[model samples]
Target: MLTISDLDYRIEARPLFDGASAQIASGWKVGLVGRNGTGKSTLLRLIREEVENPTAQSAIRLSQGAKLGWVAQEVAPTDETILEVVLAADTERHALIQESETATDPDRIAEIHMRLVDIDAWSAEARAAEVLMGLGFKHADLARKTKEFSGGWRMRAAIAGVLFSQPDLLLLDEPTNYLDLEGAAWLEGYLKKYPHTVIIVSHDRELLNRCVTHTMALEHLKLTLCAGGYDAWLRLRAERVAQLESQRAKQDAEKAHLQAFVDRFRAKASKARQAQSRVKMLEKMQDISIPLAERTVPFTFPSGEEKLSPPMLVLEDAVLGYGEGADILRKVDLRLDPDDRIAIIGTNGQGKTTLVKSIAERLPLMAGTRKVPKAIRIGYFSQDQMDELTMGETVLDHVRRALPSDTKVAQQRAVAAAMGFSHEKVDTKIEKLSGGEKVRLLLGLMAMEKPNILILDEPTSHLDIDSREALIYALNDFKGAVLLITHDVFLAEATADQLWLVKDGAAKPYAGDLADYRKLVLQADREKPDPATKPKTAAVETKPVAKVDKAEQRRLASEKRKAASPLKRKAEDAEKRLTKATAALKKVDESLAQPDQSSDQMQALMVKRGELTATIEQAEMDWLEASEAYETAINA
Candidate 1:
């Protein structure tokens, strides 16, 4: 549990949070949503006590015995192997397990057992492995040095370490940035079953919708807490916006009515006082002004009449990767159609980038017969577009460079305007722009080429929610063939019409829509147990057959109920009764602590408490066995 009261945060005389107050209840999963530079990450830092602000009042307050764990957007790995660093997060638990393994003396074993009672090593190891696998790190990769891993892999390891720590409160900043669809889906499921409270600042819409119980929106230097997920908040917020619009309309009508009355009765003596009072009231009322917002981002692709035919781009037995015998991709085959929107997906370092690079002609294919349509123009936007900007050119000059034939100032201005760059921003140097600004600029320039084939490699990587939505809208409207490789599954769902899964080395194509891809993946996942071990629960999930009907649901439910035997059921009932008795004992303790407690009542409460304590210990043992049996049944 955490609470912030009357918080006011300012930077360089600009208010970031003004009178912001919210309570994050126990087990709350919050999606901290906002635009870029709107202080989402700053707010998380404030809560984690990594940043300080003098203006903020009544600093973050946490529940008793709360531990904070954070996955920073920018992570720096210390000198250690991936496994060593992750294991170090739970050093005490690992130490206990190791000591138990080496213990030979019975007395020492007894002492270790007593210590292990407080921290369950079996549960901790299972949870850590689950997290690591979910993050896309294989057991073989765990022993690799952190320094040897790429930036993205290092970030993943850092995230895994944070989850391993199992803090009471988890603060994740853009957790899905470097993850593939599989990894993101794994994280979504993990968060759904996670025991502790979580607060995440992310631009991934689907992840937010799937994992969060609440949406914390930051706007106008204030915080608004809404129940339910992002979609629910969108619906309610739209209604509120409509209400404000209606109120503003009424104010305009009232103002016009007052003016008409004044004009009609100014000369008449009878209504002069009333009309004047109306004018005073109108002047005194607070103005209902519409809020100023960032202009709607332009969404349009270049209008090209050239149509592409089947096999727009082909790769025959391609082998890709760097260095000798380090084959990241092998024997890959892919075909592109005129209107096919292919989404390349795989876990990190599985050649997603290598494939994208080879396809985009940024890198040479190691050994392959690749073909492309004649005179096909390609527009490519790399992940690091921000760093690719010219140092001296202004934004306007950059747009002009994108169009070599367009010489007129008006035409250049129109192109700049279409990309949401206007007035002073067009004049600002490209080198001075922010990451999001640079992305918009790159996209604007790319649109000018009007290429028949588009290659966007993680275009939404550094973009804010608004910018990403804008880009998705533009891409959706483009009729040309596109090869988009991105980690954001929601963006892929919105933009891509087809999914191309890159597993191991080869590319496998899937038909149908986004939902079909999800169904396929889910069904495949159910058939195979997760490679990493996870804690088994009593609740059973029904596996969807070809036709998901009521009969299947009933059959699955009946089977699950039967799987939990009578012995397990009886033990569960006994545990429930014991928990109720324990609550009653706690009430007895409270009553005895009262100033006006009677001696007879106190003596009776003590007797009941002692009996309840013994009963609870026995119930716990029975419950543990029953739980183990229930878990086994579910896993089976």
Candidate 2:
């Protein structure tokens, strides 16, 4: 459905894409992957631009009339309900339904009905609700105004709309960044079954492996599309790299043999011709181009020199919340030993954050006791830690500030360097660093004191796969206890040995793995009642009434039919007008879609389309009022 050829683009005089090319077929889910700063987002932008404005010279090209969809931005706060916003995403269905309400021509009305059936328009609301619910929205949230949601929730709503639209070509860039673990898992399943073509830019390894049918790797300023998922791509890339190494090795040996022969025989007149020929042969041989090995800096979380005793931190019967009588988590008894590696898993807003904060001593307990040894040191990493960093300061400045006042400058620089900051990067300002770099800086600062207990909240949200792997390694090698709260299931599965589930206002141990929790989440979403299909309770009558005579009933019916005839005729006339207006609007739309139209002609057609739409809307109102009057008269 999409083809990109010779895509050469530059940013600030630096090459991002140099002759990159790829072709993706219809209904294939492709995961676009690369390390940070590799221009994955830039490539998406180029595709979107090509879709919006096709040109003869453009490198990116999409199938004709294929609708492109993406979460362009978070949904702005508005008075419209979340469900309403999603239902309106299918613009064609919305328009057709409006037109059908007042269409009087029997053939035209039947055609509209058939089209609606083809698109499954009648069940649009239920589908939209399902998408919303899968994204962590409650059933009641469907009726809530978009303005009532926070920024993150609004971003979910935006995602719901695009998914509900079901465009032919869907583009997603780090979609799980705003979701919790449950939501991300739900999205992973949804994409696996998505019918249309999908191109997602994500760093979630599980998602890349399980959801996509192919992997598109962006490396060395080039695009390589491989069959199967991320793991498959890795195997293929490894084989290719090995082949290049073998060819290069063979070529090197041949060159060395020729050189040795040339040196020994060049002065001897008997072998002079052969020596010169060997030199010519060496020059004619082509060198194999092997890519340089990529180096990823490892993350460091230093452990304290003094070994801490067991039960480093403990919370007993704790009621955690923001204030008195406002407890979010109740009766929580948990302990973190020096060897404990615990992961907190639950749905969003289930007090996971509250429990972590309470344990970290960031939030005071309303009731209950939290005990920690006087020598115990706790290192906490949260998204808010990034915000706490000074924008005007450099990486070196933050690292030095976290150290003791008497610590040497050389020691501080060494610490920063260990955190992946180079000499130039150490002096770079915080405001200019990317999200991943900022996370590294935060982790570096947290490691300064060499805390024995680490409480990390969604630490891998901004990290790429390589960095995430590095983090997993660091966490595993560390001697301190780890309490991790992250949406990345892979990281949690790799690092945490114990699972603590936060649910129903309590924190308790879970006896299952991440896969079990995933099943539970999906099952809960399936069990949620779809409002559109829910059965309504009917009122029962308590009193009985006598029946009227047959003759009187017939006379009353006759009078009612006679009284409704004129109103029915008026309704029919309004329907005819609506049908005509809708036809005119369709004609205008077709005209607008034609290529190479004069500017003035295009403007005039757009104006006509608007006017026709307004006319149809007014006719629909008129038809509805007349039809209601006819029914009322007949009932009377």
Candidate 3:
């Protein structure tokens, strides 16, 4: 069992954990959750004994004889081979084995041999190999020097090393950050069957919900332990919040009743005793403390055009790849409608990214014809933007370049604000920004286009859970088509309705849910192919609609139009309301900017401005909701 007895920690001058106490059982898998700066990592460091607990009486202790496993954040390039580095995780066993081999004394050699046997040192290499393969490393790659691999691949090696150690407790901090979808799934399964304790810090909601036995949340500078996984914790938390709010409301109402009685009859002789009693009761009443909320950054993607006709894009017998040599994807026939929400998933080094690039017009089709409506605007977020972003340019300048020439600086700032770049942060050079911040800038740039179709490739790579949720929220309200190529199963499951699997030069519709698909991928990867197996056939293409006469299709469209007319009218009305509210908000802001105003006038203007801001948010949210409903009805 792990116990924290009033442990406190601080960063610089700010206290993160103030006498926070929590207990975790021996075998429980804990999910540590909180906001970005709430110090999830710091808590992990504290557990690892790297950070000093400030409370003198605090005791952060684990069970006797318990061993810990921690993966390093950065694994520097070394002369060691990947396999050697992994095997090095068991330093004690390795040292014993070396001593046994070189020892001249028979007694010492026998003792070392017994210790090696106890630790199962003979299977260490095999275990390391298994972990390496599970993390997407080939047999040939295991002997390769760690320095030869890219940063992401090297991170995978580091993860493998940590897993191979198999300590009593494992500290996995975003273990899947650099992992492929297949690798992530494999790791999830591996952790499930693992016998040891695990505490993970991940933004993958599904992973957290599925893997964790308990949740330890750092809220309002205190660690609160809840029994159960992410979903259970959320359910319990919501109920608690509701109960607290209801009780507080009741208490306030009673206090108000007594307050009024005291106010009215305090000076009257007839009811002096009763009024005094009421006042005393009022004084005795204690205020119920509401739960404190951390600062929230509200974000929304810019709204797309109201109208887009299908099919928005199509490819007929197309070949996709970087160059003319060997194609990564061959003879792919695909169509995208304005209502399509497709997620592309596959193994690493496969054709998912290639397909997205082909669709985005970043890579030319090597073979067949492609067609797209001239009026169909596309908003694309590419993985390559991490390298393509100008190091010298500011965030605001990049947004300005991407936006229309007619767009004002004020409008650009609004878009930046939604992107989480304040006026000050906006001026920072791109080179000084973090990977996640860069991705946010790119997302903001794409959002500003307000395109009718969005084609994204690994858009969630560097994003945290909050940003990922914000993106998902925006996508849910988006009326246009979304084609997402991502390894993030949580994001994909939340946003996509259709799943496409890309493998072995073909793209096909996946016939199952994410869980089933993960099984298929992992099974395929782990199981060795047999020569006796039959040759594979082409993937069976499933058309959205069966072939019908043009007249019949037209009739169906006409019927849909008739059914959707009311919703369409409501959506248009909402759009108008939003426009008017925005105009009113602008006028209020303009009035506030004027100098030499009376204090009372300024106060009223501020109140009016606040009201207008709320009005705009509600109006826009309503508009999106109505628009999405109208679109859904028409497509239904």
Best by lDDT: 2
**Model 2: clashing residue pairs?**
none
Clashes of each: 0, 0, 0
The digit string of per-residue lDDT tens for model 2 on 1-636 reads 998998888765888888998999999999999999999998888888833434312888899999999998777556799888888888899899899999999999999999999999888888888898899998778887775565688899999999999999999999999999999998999999999999999999988999999999999999999988888999999999999999999999999999999999999999999999999999899889998857899988889989877789888998899885568988888888887999999888889888888888888889999999899988888865544577557888888888889999888888888899888899887755788998888887887778899989988878989999999999999999999999988899999999999988999989999888899889873336466643223458878878879999999989998878998899889878876886687678778767678866865775576578668767777876788788889887
Whole-structure CA lDDT of model 3: 0.79
Q: For each candidate, what TM-score against the reference?
A: 0.74, 0.82, 0.76
Q: How far out, in Å, is residue 242 in model 1?
A: 1.2
In model 3, which runs have C-alpha deviations exceeding 4 angstroms? Answer: 52-59, 74-79, 257-285, 292-309, 324-326, 404-408, 431-436, 527-636
Off by over 4 Å in 2: 50-57, 101-108, 407-410, 525-527, 531-636
What does candidate 1's lDDT look like per residue over 453-517, in tens digits? 88888887678777788878788888788888887877887878777777767776866666665
User: Candidate 1, which segments miss by more than 4 Å at Cα?
Assistant: 57-60, 73-79, 90-116, 258-277, 303-305, 322-327, 386-397, 405-417, 422-432, 511-636
Model 1 TM-score, 2 decimals = 0.74
User: Candidate 3, residue 126: CA error in Å?
Assistant: 2.3
Better of 2 and 3 by TM-score: 2
What local distance difference test score does each model get?
Answer: 0.75, 0.86, 0.79
